[model samples]
Target: MKSIKFTVILIFMMSLTTFHAQEVVVVDSTGVAQENNEVLTTSIVKDTIKVPFKRFKAEGVTAVVGDYVVLDSDIDKSYLELQQQGIGVEDITRCQLLGKLLEDKLYAHHAKQDSIVVSEAEITSQVDQQIQYMVSELGSEDKVAKYYRKDNIAELKTELYTVNRTLKLASEMQRAVIEKVEVTPEETSQFFYSIPEEDRPVFSAEVEVAQIVIEPEVNEEARQGVIERLNSIREDIVDNGSSFATKAVLYSKDGTAQKGGLIEGIQRNSPLAKEFKDQAFSLLEGEVSEPFETEFGFHILTVDKIRGQEVDVRHIILFPELSQDVIDAARAEIDDLREKIVNGEITFEEAAKKYSDETETKNNGGQLVNPVTGDTRFDLTKMDPTLSAQVYNLENGEVSKVYNDRDYTGKSKFKILTVTNKYDEHKADYAKDYEKIKALALKEKQIREIEIWQDKKIKETYVNVNEDYLDCDFSSNWIKK
Candidate 1:
């Protein structure tokens, strides 16, 4: 997994597709910390040292954006981070690197001027999470400290905290700039017409699908067995002094199990299931909860630490098994529901409202909301293969055969799909594709706003690019020559 800082940088980079770190000590690919040299040695894995660290470095300043100093090594560090993320930087020139860093600092600098404050708690939580991830990947806390060449984890955390905080400020500032910018209906129509007839974008076929799902029912025996297993695991950890992390690695079914079930930065208002938050916040540090059930499965959680409204925790989840007979029964149930709709005995919407087991869509007549656009339309070309295969050939109002599928947790279920709406491939139309056109217009407007902001800020702010980068082409006026 990439570090939190890399994730932050990646997000910030995406925001600047039309528009677009720190330093101190250097960590080599051999996992050794060394002093600055005239020429840095190359290490294929050196990029894995993901944190932007600062020790007293003799590296020259590459540029100055507002109050932030961009060091020459900072560009190298960003390159290494990109390399570690498996992103090819062979074509990414040093000037481009400096330009991105300059843009980021300007945002962060002005964010401070505008009194935008990133929560210390949030930064601390992220740093801790990053540490935990590195520890999990590198195999130990001592190894993580060594890799980053820090005296201890505290020093590493402090440095990472500063870097992450600034990156976050840049992100927050970008959001603040464009969050309220929206295109009016007239603007959408104008954007649609502005594109020449020959240059208009052709949209792919799309579908709005609805589903009625029936999850296999686990017997009471299986349910109790899972809960009891979790209880036994909890007992061993509490009474036998066994390692919670080891047990999680051995037995947890959750995706975080490899990280010893560690979940960091879980706040009270975090978008987790209610049952989970209730169980998580109820425990004090080092206190293990008794086995409890959530939408995922039965879990026994241990709170590692708590900071104000946030908690870092670990959990082991055990899902109850469904008997083959029970699975068959669910398949039959959905099949019968499909028949009812097919025979016109009951409408798909009515059957979905009355019988569908999927919570997210059941109340909405089983309409699947496109996770990307928060709308019902899904472009088949961009849809997930499994979903696209199911709905690709279905006509409007046509029902699909009952399909066996597994939810995110790998729990077996059966569902019947129906196409609620279908749009054939067509050229952009003001009346037919208003939403898509509106989105494009709004994005163009946001890009314009950012460009204007960047131009104005560069003039007002103190920016000085080193002479080496004076010839490089940048999107904004960073070189005040």
Candidate 2:
């Protein structure tokens, strides 16, 4: 999802909106190892490449908040993958990588200059946890160690953590800018009512609830069995030195297995729902992890390099089956929660913990998140038809009769929903718009502050620009004019 941004930019500055949790790899500006002596080619998948370090290029710029912006997310791999996926375009992918890099450098520089610190200790701790998580996802430490070509799985983690932290700090700075904007009652009311009646959002009674969920415990023996199976397969691959992709097609359980288990050109830290993410990135090239475990089950990993802004990896995921007896026990428990809530013995929130399907929702009282937006609020149209139908009919405190729901794998599961809160549609009132108004107002103030600082910095810094780029269109008149 894209966030609102208002910043002045130079000709070289790029802008990108990333998929959440996708890792945004930052390039080394101080000195990227020089590439082959040949001219950089903008076309072809593997252009006889010999490069010391990765670099990005983009074309067709846009202006955002005075910054010459572009999107250069994945010039090479994105294009090849998109073409495979039936998306054809050159400049589009070209800009994607450039935009990501520009934004990364700009905000990262500001964070360091402002002394927004991410401590060395914090980075090290996060790296350690990440290594363990990778081991878990790969089903064992050895599986991870073999894939990365590193002596061990823990090497260079501090380096990765530092880059990750830099990006994190930039995000916080962006949030600070947007969250502080101040908007008044008049502004909110005017912005809201100014829209046509037909366009005004029809708000149904919407309930916002928080929840914590714990999945049912899978039998330990069953989990161990899966890990053992994976270990044997990994042994076969290693012993024979067989092609990993070829083996993945034959044995990998993930959907991408048929394609040799390769997932490429994806941004870093993207919320690809699986504990395998940490494991996938943990290995250095040519290394593998032994069998490890996660919420999804067991897995083994093979990590490629951090090429350009993306990392390539593959995995075999193994999930254990819960017996019919386990399913019945969980369902019966959830049913009992309904009875207690019906009897007024305890609040639905209370029963959620002591009873109910304790996994995936009880922590926040069985509330479903807006999966698409990660929002609690959903217009009926944006909701799942079956769930929305039930929600519309049920009054507050009403527990839905057991209905069908699908887990990530599209497997059918039984679920009960409760309508905990609702807001009816009405014209926007300033009193009710405090958060939004305050946010907008604060943003405007931040831009003013930054603008003042930027104007002063531009005037004071001893900067020089080559003639061709000096006249290039930019967000601010920061270059020598």
Candidate 3:
């Protein structure tokens, strides 16, 4: 996955369109106005302009918008970066890119004018999250530092802080401009009807699935053993001067272990377990805590840094390894429940609500929700790998046998999956695809609002583009020389 900074830049570039055709003008030293066909230099009075003739070699400026300036080399660098990312470098693409950068600068300029302030704590948190993501992708902090030619992850974060802040400010400004945009049902219906029949989209097969999850219960002895192991690791770090990150990578069972157990930008009021949150927030900088237990497992952590109510920390988590007997017990329990469900002794919904260990699904009577759509239905291909494989051959209203699987936290669990509903591949339907069509309409409205905002900002901001780029169509009036 691309880093957050790159993702923001891509969004800006992809959201813009070319402007309509317009006249272009160029002025020369002789005070003669001519059609814009090539680059021209305008002479300035020697006494009025301060030129660093001795200490500087000047390059041409590609664009100037108010106090913001885009050099020729900046545009060249952006084009090269796009090419590296396998994006097209056609003339229209470059024009669109230039327009996006110009608009971004205007958004930042206006944000400053409005006295919009982002806290240092927020920026630091963002930097930490981005660094964690980068470390995860590149396999290690060492690898990430090498990739960026930095001495360490801290250096990389410092380098990216300004870029991230600018992106964040621009994004906030964009949201302020369009946060009130909404599409009503009537608007959605009208937009759907406006699409020609031949141009309507087709959808793939979809399914609605649900499950009852049963996590294996670790015995007291096993739990104590995990705690003891974490205690030993903590001792090693405290007394032996051993690297916390190295120990975490070697011993931690959490998903973040690959990134040296770093959890970035965690707030005091975050959705962590109360026990875990209290323990983390109470630690002094660089102080390691004693082993503590939460729902997931035993953990020993040290606070790397703290900013106000937020913290950056590294931890080693050791989950009790479930014994074979525990696994068999969970499997047997799920199997008995399945039998009861199949024999009509109890409904699956009732079993899920009464016995399933998955809090989110149990409360919903085992109904799986699609996070992206906030619906129970999902494309078969998009379903969980373990659930989809078992449900692929099952018909609607059929239940699968108890199967061992892992949940999002990577804990082993036994589950009985049911396919509640299924739909074959079909073309878009007004009644069936109302949510999808409505989302599209909402996006279209948002784009229109953004375009209007851009046009107003373009006219208000002082902008000037080089004659070479002035000939290209642009979405904004950037040639206000």
Candidate 4:
């Protein structure tokens, strides 16, 4: 139990750790190229467990968790994955990796027993996205197949579907186990204090920032120019018998341009701007639509195919130009607002509510929340580089000069930021860091729930450890004999 406890704790910590996003090459013992793997996850269990099966040769079954078999190669591949993820696996033995794999298989096996259904469409969509990403990265579908050692794209997709389905099942089962678990304020306080004074987590310097953004106004001429450009593109496809994809390659501005502006499996409720979806759904097969304006830019769409409630479509986006005068006016407007706040004539939050153009943050008084942590405070060490550079030297309540920036869609905007609050590096405090502590407590509670669920499920299920792994110190008892 002590060994198993260590394994579980390590797994939990690793699950919380973020991994590097760079591409990783997976090789064999002799350094021969086997597969090109991506950093699908920085975690230990689910994402890291996705082993490229291109040239994999199984070393026979090492254990049986209900209906699922754990092959010896699974442990080997997991070790390689951890190493590639920059996790030091020297201290992490095969027995431990196997233990994790067994746990995953057990979860997946019972997910079926518990009637947790992972939709085939969802799994297929995930596979398609994965393949598409790989193709874009590796340059071609053939290259992607070769990188994975698949004979063809079809083989790669088939293998990927199996891998994705199993992962989804395991994930769903784990979610089912711990979904209801929660931590109370008392539990959070207890968890924080239970740690020895010398061992409590240290927090880095953090700041809460607020901002007001102003986008340059587009003149009628610029708007009409973009609309006319899109109309011309639509005409070329509909009238001149030109290829929409070729036109997208020659003219579109969005990231999807490389894929000929293709967007797949778009439901009516997809996160695209409402106007874009409205135009998309209105178009008949092969019928190109007139230009439509969305927040990103102007677009003209053609529905390549429609199946049920989903549409497979292609479209091109073109951003209207902002005149220098309008751009200067936007900067001047924000600059004036900043001066008023600094002179105490208007509060920053008050000005933000009345004038900021960013809808997401404006209602919150322009308070920028950390998207990752759902908190207003951002740790300096982990802050976005561009944002850190902007506010690094700011004192509490000090407003920054107007700065130029681009939104996610690359639309230019002018903004001024203020560090509303700043905290120097310090040891964790109960009241000061209540939210962080509560999150930690909740995660610990969830881990315990998963462990408890595994214990009960392992006993009821017919789990068999091969003689080779019989000596493994698994947290859950899998060796019934």
Candidate 1 vs. true structure, TM-score: 0.77
Ranking by TM-score: 4, 1, 3, 2
- Candidates in order: C-alpha RMSD to true structure: 7.3, 12.6, 10.6, 5.4
The C-alpha lDDT values of all candidates are: 0.77, 0.52, 0.71, 0.78
What is the per-residue lDDT of model 1 for residues 306-398, given as tens digits with 9 covering 90 to 100? 988878899998899778889888888888888889999999999999999898999999999999888899998999999999988888889
For model 4, how does the per-residue alpha-carbon lDDT over 1-481 read when each residue is reduced to its tens digit? 1223655565454322311122432322112235454222222332232333344354577888787877766666666667767888646766777777777778789999989977665667667667776777889999887876678889878876776666667777877887889899889988999888888888999999999999898889999988888888888788899999999988999877887988887888788899988988888999888888887888889999989888889999899987889988998999889889999999999999999999999999999999999999999999999999999999999999888998756778999999999999999899998999899888888877877887888889988788866766666677864
Clashing pairs in 3: 18-474, 19-474, 19-475
Tell me the lDDT of model 1 at 225.
91
Model 1 misplaced stretches (Cα beyond 4 Å): 1-60, 71-97, 113-165
Worst 10 residues of 4 by lDDT: 24-33
Cα lDDT of model 2 by residue, 221-272, tens digit: 6677877888887887788787778878987777777667776544455566
lDDT, model 2, position 358: 45
> By descending lDDT, how would the candidates be arranged?
4, 1, 3, 2
What does the lDDT read for residue 474 in candidate 2? 37
Q: State, as a TM-score between 0 and 1, how close model 4 is to the true structure.
A: 0.85
Q: Which ten residues in a row have the lowest lDDT in candidate 1?
A: 18-27
lDDT of 4 at 123: 65
User: Clashing pairs in model 4?
Assistant: none
